[model samples]
Every structure is written in structure tokens, then in C-alpha cells.
Target: MSLEWLQRVFGAKVLQFVMILFTYETEEECNTIKDDLKRNPDLKQLLEKCGGRYLTCNKMMNNQSEMRDLMKKIEHLFNENQQQCYTGEMPNTASIRKKKLESSEHQCGHTSEMESNAHLNLILLGKKRAGKSASGNTILGREVFMSKKSSKSVTRDAAVKSGTVNGFPVTVYDTPGFYDPKMGTEEIQKILDKVLLKCESGPCAFLLVIKADSFTEEEIKTVEKIEKLLGEERLNKTWILFTRGDELQEENITINEFINDTEALKKLIQKYDQQFHVLNNKIKGHSDQARLLLVKILQRSFGIK
Candidate 1:
């Protein structure tokens, strides 16, 4: 909902593309936001100030087909812009597929080796208020995505931001939380479909974010829903990213100790061959926690080591 992140990474032109998609829950809502944008003179000036013509957002009002076409157009433009900066950032999808097919036999159920120069796509997934958004900011080492503590979900749609982490081009997709009462089943499915498309970049690391303190019945059901959505095939690409390590530290408990004490958590980690990382989002500024986690992800998920 915050344009700060979009405006910071991308200019106002991309914001037009994002504004259309962000409020695109229903045709009615999309139309309402479109009308609002039209009436806002400052928004018009903002685009003009950025040397961008105001377009596409109006075109999306007609039908879903138009909206879909606009999405593809904007996404291509965005990726093209991003690829211009980082050398070999996102590899050709066809070549990635070919390489994965060739290396499938050697991959013992893990994701295939990523292109040497390819960027890492880290998809954050979990229940609402599980610190997924905050973890995203932590990983990026900046507050690009909005984060706060509230009963309501902060991220209502899928938002992405990219930056270099430890010299690797990393893009983080912060998705809406699972089992969010605010979101309908169909809406959730649409989000999943979009995210899966991004995953085609190849060798994505699916970080299942959860609080470090407790794993309750609700958390158990949430994990089941995540597994079902990801499917057993993607289990290899998944890793448990436990947030709020500061809480565990307060109680003099290690992440491993917390998991060992919780039977469900212990078994879940074992299910993924002990692939996990703990992040203390409270401890910001020049911390190596995020860097270390990326290293582990690259080594385990992408075979970068």
C-alpha cells in the first residue's frame, strides 16, 4: 500500500503499473482506484515530473484481458530495466530450463545449480503477522517494504524489491500472509499463480517465515496450508526462516534449542533435512545475520558453494 518502496527503487512510471495491480482485488475496486488517481492532480504532476507519460492504468479499466496485457508489458519493462544494471542478473528462462533438465539426474531432489551470474529470488511465505515483511526489510538491509505490528495484515498483495547482498543480485518477493481472513480463496490463488511465475527464474529459495517463540496449533495448520500450496515437489527448495531471534536470546535459548523443545518444529526441520535460518530483525545496522543466511541459501538451495 506504501508507494515509498516503489518510488525508491523504481521511478514514477513503474508506480503506475504497481498502482493498478495493488488494488486489483476486484474489477470494482480497480475502477474506484483508477478514478481516484485521475482526480489527483499531484499524481499527474508526479508522473510528468519524472518525465513519464500517464498511461496503462487507464487501459486496465476495460477488462481482465487488458489488465493481463498491461501486467506483462510493465513486467517486461521492469525486468529489462533491472537487467541493464546487473551483469547476467536474470538468465534466459529457456536456457535455465534446459540446464535444469540436463542437471536433474545429478540433483538429489534439491534445486539445480543456478547460473553463475544469476540473481537469487527469495520468496517469503507464512501466516499473517509472522514477520515476513520485516524479514524482507532485514534481508534487504533497508525498510523498502512496509512493516508494523497490528491485527490486520500489512501486505495485502505481492510486492517485490531487488538489491545486491554480499555481491549477489537478490530480489525478494514479500507475499500476503496465508490464512488471512481479509483475503478470499480465489484472491489467494491468484496471488499464488503470480508468485509461481516469478519462481520460474530458477533456483528460488522459498523462506517460510515464522516467529521464534512458539509453534502453536494455528501455526501447524498454517504449515500444512503452505506445504499444500508449495506441493511436495517444492519441499526441497523450501527452508524455515525463524524470525525474532531476539526473543529467543532474551530467554537464553538457541534456535536449535527452541526447535528441539517443540516437537512439531523439530520434525518440520527434519522433513527439510535441517534447512533453516534464524533472524533477529530487532538487531539492525551492519549485522552479518542476513549475509550469513544468504550464504547458507546459496550453498544449500542453489549449490553455489
Candidate 2:
């Protein structure tokens, strides 16, 4: 809505965004649009003072409707809310990229690898028996968090486990399940706040664990509650991690095909930019998949090449 609100989500500096628009009459008339923007008396001075690359689409002129809609979408970025802060001097293209890479690193640890590589602090959250603890153990490459069959949540308090994956140190925080009739809202919030204290620099990712075999309307409501708690800003980094990957194998279907076929799951993933991953916590040799998951998390945390 407001430019100030958008600036807060993206950042306070113009360095993070560097798109400059230019108009072109015809594709055949000019091979370059930079020259046009440079020649225009108004734009020429503007470019000299604040250098930026020009993005020109010939269709913008030929299709006014599409151009207007596209402009509106671009303006929304300016109007989007700022989720994190960037302090100190303004960065150049290289510096901005480097900062993103640094953000990918886990910040809740003091290991040497954590210092050099991107550190990731991932919190596993979901309802009881959704396999959050098992998912954590799977990602960490060990049974750091207990996973067992139970009517009640196995993890009463938030527990953290750390390990290295593909040279990057990843920290996993297994939090208690939601909608616990015994626990009050204030208690759950307090537990979350305590777990978040370790993430002073902010978490690289949030894993919303769900069983692959079943996701009901009640579970959807639970997800909505989680989303509300995280808010729009943090939800961008949240990943819908569907556990019990063995079910997909047994069904002889891929995760993509499964979600695409399921109407409810389809919409859920789409709402979050299709940011979801599958894992069979019971399966052995999950290191590869875990690494693959880490790769996605890093790309989501940093910038995909």
C-alpha cells in the first residue's frame, strides 16, 4: 500500500533493487534502449547521477493492458512490507549478493563452519503426530529428537539439534504441537519466544511438518493458525515439509504429481509459492535428500543462481 511499508520488508536501501524502465517505439528502429534513456533530457541526467540497468519490453507499448498490469505488480514490490533490516553502508551489486549469501548461513551457532559458510536455523512445527520430531532427526542425520507413536506430543518443550549438511551447519529446533487442549495460548507463545531467542540473527527457514498420507480440513485450520502466528513476513521463509515420504513411494507417485492432483494440497503449496519438500523420515540413506533440501533452503535463503 505505502512505499514506506514496502521499504521496510525489502530494505531501506535502493541497492537491493536496481531495475530502471525505458520505452522503445519499435524493435527494428533501435538495437539499444539504454541510448534512448540516456538521450532523453530528463532521464539522461537521472541515469548519470544514479546508475542502474534498464529493462525494456517491446510489448509494453504494443500491449497497454498488459503493461499497466505489469506496472501495478512491480509497484506492489515497492508497496510490500519489509521483513528484515540491513544496517551500515549502502552496498553495490556485488555487496548486495554477498549479503544474501551471508544470510543463508546459520547464525545461532559459533562453529567455524557456521562462520565461513551459510548457517541455517530451521524450526520444525506442526500438530501432534505430524512427524515434526522425526523430520528434524531426518534432517539432522541422527536421532537427536525422539520420534515415536503417541496420542500426545512427544516433545513437550522446544528442543534444538545442530549438525552439518554439505559443509553448512544447520540448526533444527523441534517445537511442541499446536491445538493442545492442555496448554494455553500464552504458554505456546512463550515456548516459541524462548526457542527464537537462539535465532538472534533470524532463522534461515521454518519447516511446517505434515504427514504426506493425510491432510484434513482440521489440519488445514492448524496450518492457518501457524501462518497467522508467523505473520506474512516470516511465512515467506516457511516450507511445507510433508513427512512420511514412503507413502508416496507405496502409492507409486511423485510428490509433485501428488500435490498437483490433490485439490487442497495444491492450493496450500501455491499459496506459499509452491515452497514444499518431501521426506521419508523412516527411510535410510536420507543424506542425499537432506542435502537436496538444504540446497533448496539455501537458495531460498540466499539467491538462486
Candidate 3:
């Protein structure tokens, strides 16, 4: 006889036979049978009885032990299929339990590299009045930091600037403005620790700002100290940013000409593999230009298309 005709003639008896076959097979084999049975209207209706416990058990049993226990219950129900107790209505239960189990299993194999779609956290580190806050605001395309003229360190705390640039999420962390001698080594170390914690994924780029008007001995020394802390290889990820580019207007000097003129600055740039950019915060469109340059530098350095 056809399976449908056989099931119709012997409703509970057929379910009992199917359950017997389900218990002997592996979980994968049982799932295949379950999918096949779902395509049939009569078998689905018959299975919907027996408290619909099988459906709940199938959804909730995530591990092997739970699956084995569920299989035993199904076997017992099949053995007593002719009894009236096996004909009860389905029970009420929340559906999220099964969905939660499925989702957890699906995410178990995910790795940190697989989750690397998170935004790159870039930090701007430099001396006070070096336009670090302005550079950050430019990158974010908004006034995220309070820039003032008093020169009392506008960014006292580490403020985070986050926004999407060209469809890529970019985070720029503005650290407390570093000044030499006045801000001791202990204070500087604290700032470094905080920056590392905030940019744990890795700082895609480090923008070290120096005023173009005059490069001092202290400035060079401070840059070297910072570099030592970040490590020599970190220069691959470093980009020298020359602030106050308007100051070079008197001589009409190009950024390359200016860099070549200063021995200390030239050496620093060369040591970092010649990664530098001139940023004029006083000009109208300079901020946007600097931000675009940084984006290009990061893409090239990190191979981010």
C-alpha cells in the first residue's frame, strides 16, 4: 500500500513504526526523516499530537546528551502509541529557546579575524597647540573637540571622535596634548596606557603633529621618546603631520622643501620611511585635505582596498 494509505488506515501505528526507525538512526538521519515527513500533511498532523513534545525536544536539544534523552522519550511514546495517553494536545512553550540554541551554535566557530569589520581606531598624538583637536574635528567632519586660544590644553582628557568617512567607519582618538618637561614621564606613560587600551584592535595610523613655524630641539627629543615607547617598527604605521603650514608662506616653501631644510625633521621622516603630510589648519580647505590624505595613507598601509 502507499505510505499515505497505510498511515490513514493505521494512524498511531504508523507513527510508532516511524519513531522506531528514528531511534535507531543517527541525529542527522533523523533530521532527514523529519524534513521528509514535514512535506506530508497527514504525518505532520499525526505528529502534532502527543503534546507536540517531539517538536519542542528537537528544537531544545542542542548537545548529544539532550538528543539521546529525547530519542529515548520518542521510543517510549512509540511503544505505547496504542494507549489513549499518547493522543494529548500540544503544550505551550516559548520559541526563542530553540532560536537561541541555534544562534549560539552558529557563532561558536567565529574568530577575531572574522570579526575584523569593526572600525579602525586612529590616534592623534602630539604637543599642545599642535592642532590635534582641529585635526580630529576635520577627520570626523564635525566639531567634536573644543578648540580655544588660551593654550591651556583644550583636550585635557582623551576624547573619542567616531564617524564614517567614504563608507568606512573611522575612529580618531584625541589624547591629552603632550608638552615636554612640564608633563612628566609618569603622566605621559599614563596617557600611553590609556591610548593602548582604547585602541586595542590596533591604531591604523598615528598622526604626530609638529608646528611648521619652528621645529625645536625639545620637539625632536619628544618625538623620539614617543617613538621609542611605540617601538621603531611602529613608524610603518606612523604619519608625520606638519601643522601651521601657513607659516611657510613668507618663503613660499613647499612641504618637501621645508622637510629637506630641517636636518632633525628630515632624519625623523626618513627613519619613518618618509611618511609625512603638511596640514595647514589656518586655511579654509586644509582640514578636509588632511583627512582625505590620512584615509589614503591608512588604506595603502593596511591593504584595505
Candidate 4:
């Protein structure tokens, strides 16, 4: 069920109770209720609290009849609470269904003190000469890696840099920009496999660098393929790092507006629910913004506060 559905039925307190039920319920009848709760825990818990209970009679015919009656009562309770919560508005069915799938994928885990102190792992990806290396340096607040202007990719392999940002640790991975179109599709797959192996686990967030003055069709294609290779939902863990945002300021146009105006850019944002962050690698003062953005990305990835 969508988070909206959860909120509508149980607010937040009882929703937490339903989560506990999912963790503890194991009997056949309780498991069935738990499965229903998994879909709409808020609704199930609210119904149970409001004089609703599972009834299984000894007689087979009576058991079936009672199950039907209990289901109808449950539905009625849900409808009543939904109206009270939404005030005459109907919930979006698609959103509710999508949220059910998302909820299943997200396992609520306990966070230890050490895990709370963990830094976010951000991987930078783009075409050659897209200033990916410079962006990393800017985020580190120093020239930690070589930023070359040669035609070949300066980062021949994946390299990681870790540092503290506003008291939270941040690790940025500088990777080779995949730009060779002449190579066969299989070769590109091999290259990506190697890169993924080097990364160990996929980075928590991907920073797709695009030069402020230059946006190319190749960059768009790269983003699309990456989205396909990693499921579309994975794009939520991405932030567009537009290097040289200072140049956009020089033009008296905000990078946000410029990206919104471009159809290709708009498509990327829409695909990821408008989740994009801009960084001016040349601006020293704005590095904090980049760090803050990383924190937000990490929170989303790990479901941390």
C-alpha cells in the first residue's frame, strides 16, 4: 500500500504497531492478516482496534461464511476511515499499488550507532571531459585527484576518496567516463561488469556529471542505458551533478530552470521524480551544498533520518 494509504488508515502510531505485527505474527490466521497488513497495515490495524477480529468456526461451511462476513466488515471499516482521513477524496489506485510493491522491497532494519555514523558512497559517471574528476575534487574541498584535459579518460579505473562533510563522512568514487561508441555492445557490457566488480556493491548514489556549457546526446543515451541496466527505481538514488554551474550564473540563468526547459533533461528528472542536484565545481563556497545533497541522498538510500 502507498504511504498515503498507511497514513489515512492508522496515522503513524498504529502503523508502527502493524509493523510490529508483521515482525511477530506467525500463525496461519495471523499470517494471513499480516499479509493483508503488508498491503495496507494502517487499514488492517485500524479495523482490528475498532472491534474487528478474525473468526474461524469449527464447521467448514460456517467458517467460510464467517470469513466473508469478516472481510466485508473489514472493507466497510476501511472505507469509513478512508473517508474520514481523506474527507471525500478517493485514493489513487495506481499509487497505492506502486506503494505496496515499494513497501515490500523496503525492510525496516534497526540502525546501530556505528551504522548511523556511516558515510554515503557516491559514484560519479559521465562521458569523458565531463569534469567528473573536477567535481570530486570540488566536493573534497581540495585537489585530491588529477583532473586532466587530454582526449583519453584520466580515471582509467575506479578510485575512491573519503572525507568528512559537515561531520558526516562522505566517500566519492571517481570512475572512467564511458564514451567509446565504436566499441561493440558486448565490450561495453564487459567494461561495466568490471566497473561494478571494482565498486564491490553499487554506490549508494550516482552523480551524472554534465558540463554546464555542453550537454551532449551521448550523455542522454548513457543515462537512459544506465536506468535500464539498473531498474528505473534505482534512479531515485541519483543526482545530476552539473559542473561549472558558475557559467550558468554568468548567463543570468539558473541551472534548475535551464534543465527544466530542456526536454531530455526534463525526461531524466521525471523518470527519477525530479531528483537532481547541481554543483559548481569552480565555486569554493558552494561545496557545502554538495555535501548536504549527499547527506539527503544517503538518507533516502538507507532510510536513515
Instruction: Identify the candidate with maximal lDDT.
Output: 1
Superposed on all Cα atoms, model 3 deviates from the true structure by an RMSD in Å of 21.7
**Residues 1-305, model 4: lDDT tens digits:** 22323444334433322211122223575556557755886556555553443443333343566567656755665665563333322335544754664466445544343242344566787777888898888877778778978877787666779775644556778876766544444655566566556553534677878887755688888777655655566566777777777788889988778876788777777766666677777765335666667656755655554
Cα TM-score per model: 0.63, 0.61, 0.58, 0.56
Span of ten consecutive residues with least summed lDDT in model 1:
1-10
Candidate ranking (TM-score, best to worst): 1, 2, 3, 4
For model 3, residues 53-124, the per-residue Cα lDDT tens digits are 453233335567767876787666656665334232211122244345446755885433212333567778
Q: Rate the local accuracy (lDDT) of all candidates.
A: 0.75, 0.72, 0.65, 0.63
* Window of ten residues with lowest summed lDDT in model 3: 86-95
Q: What is residue 41's positional error in candidate 2, in angstroms?
A: 41
> In model 1, how large is the Cα lDDT of residue 235?
89
Off by over 4 Å in 2: 1-117, 200-203
Q: Which whole-number lDDT from 0 to 100 does residue 62 have in model 4?
A: 39
In terms of TM-score, how similar is model 3 to the real structure?
Answer: 0.58
lDDT of 2 by residue, 188-275 (tens): 8888878777773744688998888877887898899888777788888899999979889998989988788779889999988878
The number of the candidate with the highest TM-score is 1
Task: Mark the regions of model 1 whose C-alpha exceeds 4 Å error after superposition.
Answer: 1-113
> Model 3 off-target regions past 4 Å?
1-115, 180-182, 249-251, 283-288
Judge candidate 2 at residue 25 and give its lDDT. 65
Better of 3 and 4 by TM-score: 3
